[model samples]
Target: MYELTVVVTKVLGTCSSEVPMKPGDYLTVRNGALRIPEGGHICLYALQSLMPVLTTKERRIGEKHSDDWVWRVHHVQCPDPEGRVIFHIVRSGEKAEMPPYTPSEPCPQPQTDPSLADLRVIVEEVRGKCTSGMQPGDGFLLKSGRLYIPAGRHFCLYALQATLPLLPAKQRAPLDGDWLARDNHIICPDPAGNVVLRIERV
Candidate 1:
């Protein structure tokens, strides 16, 4: 799926301009006629791509409804395709901040020996710091930028894809162990950034 970058905007007196928003902020449309999500703002890109039925409403309100677009936040039912929709907002500086990697050498090959102990790829440095670390048995945490896998927890290849709905078809692989890794980094398909999930041999 593709992403649409939408910056929040505000108006003071006669001037109107874009504004920064945090995760907790809410978004509305059609003069608060529709509330995108209660606590988390809906990712317009996801809403358009994943749920075909919802696209009409989003397009109508965002593009065709009215030019005024003076919306006030209100409570309304959110259309969740599978679960609650959570949007991840990363600044331009943060998206450009990639983890240090060796430029000359290629990425390490996946372990193939069955006799060797299975490596547990735990969530190491998510955006340079680990926020609530996910346990191995916790399965997959689907948050956009929050990295997972480094606590040496073994996860099935199928389980990893379940967390990343936006991952391109080309990147989907059936085998386990950092299948997303390239150039010494394993990147996940996040709306905000190509998040580097930790990959370590344990």
Candidate 2:
């Protein structure tokens, strides 16, 4: 995957990134920075992390920014012959690899309503200070320039790999073979901050 950054204007209102990508190009949001003007306010919609993942067809990354938000949107051209692409969100320090293209069965089409799919789990609240001691089913969501994990629990990588298929088609990383090696699970770099996660439909 190729790494790149796009700086969205603060006041221009709903700025689109200059990244040159077509219909099937896969994009992943790895990091971001928001520059809010003094006395300016950041909106709840702008603070959300799942916006980029769910958007397609003239893809937009964020709500109209009151401040400049420079987000790192990594790109990878679709290697499959069918002109289909897969996106993945990985922790900063984890290994990055292309998901294999398996040509046997067709991939499940993504649902319009994310809640109707089993692939997403929204974070309702954090019980403690960004806890990592979560149960086997817990997972983190990468957005808002931070890795948001449960406040008081640790989530295991093995458990995450097992649960990936449960994510909505859009949220789950596409894998050909050896899904465990292909899936990228995110974790909070810091264990002090708290956050709520909403599963975005692919």
Candidate 3:
């Protein structure tokens, strides 16, 4: 697995990952191990080193298919001290946003904002189609970039938003207590956490 530090906005536009250091908008990249889940997740690992940036149709030199340079977003680990892909970073893709860590039980409640009223879902198309707000073709955006959909959940959301569509009339049940919002200030839970996010809301 290749370990490249890319900006979230570049890869995922502005959806914002809950994990930090992603440089994207959605879902923060938890520093660990992961993998390329499926065809829907084909793009996750596609952006690797020396990988050609050609589309599926562009590589057809002839009906014989001479060259095929593809890039799938892989669920690689969060890079180790030697910067290696030695774990599962979860490339759930369009299958489901949060795989591997399936919420065994229902998402716990007050359930924060009912039906995710305060939150906005950025797009997570299976074939790399950007969704709603934050930026044109960027993905989606909540208020001031607080909470965002993780890449792992992209599959679920795509199925839900595209096929099912989580509209006002048919909204799904939301998890309680744990809400995904833009935390301008990351208050240090421990006095000793090797972090550097001192300022609130950059």
Best model per TM-score: 2
- Model 3, range 100-124, lDDT digits (tens) per residue? 2212122233444454333344322
lDDT of 1 at 8: 25
Worst 10 residues of 3 by lDDT: 193-202
Q: After superposition, how far is residue 97 of candidate 2 from its true place, in Å?
A: 26
- Considering TM-score, where higher is better, how would the candidates rank from best to worst? 2, 1, 3
Which TM-score value belongs to model 1?
0.20
- Per-residue C-alpha lDDT of model 1 across residues 1-202, encoded as one tens digit per residue: 1122222221112211011122233322221122223223323233332332222223324443345332221112223333333333222222422222211221134423323322223333334322223332333221222222323333322223333443332123334555444422354333232334443333
Stretches of model 2 off by over 4 angstroms after superposition: 1-75, 84-120, 128-190, 194-202
Of the candidates numbered 1 and 3, which has the greater lDDT value?
Answer: 1
lDDT of 2 at 156: 29
Alpha-carbon local distance difference test for all models:
0.29, 0.32, 0.25
Relative to the unseen true structure, what is the Cα RMSD of model 3?
Answer: 17.6
Q: Please, what are the lDDT tens digits per residue for candidate 2 over residues 24-98?
A: 222222222212222122121222332343222123436554442423433322333342222343333446564
Clashes of each: 9, 14, 57
- Global Cα lDDT for candidate 2: 0.32
RMSD in order of candidates: 18.4, 16.7, 17.6
> Per the 3 Å backbone cut-off, how many clashing residue pairs does candidate 2 have?
14
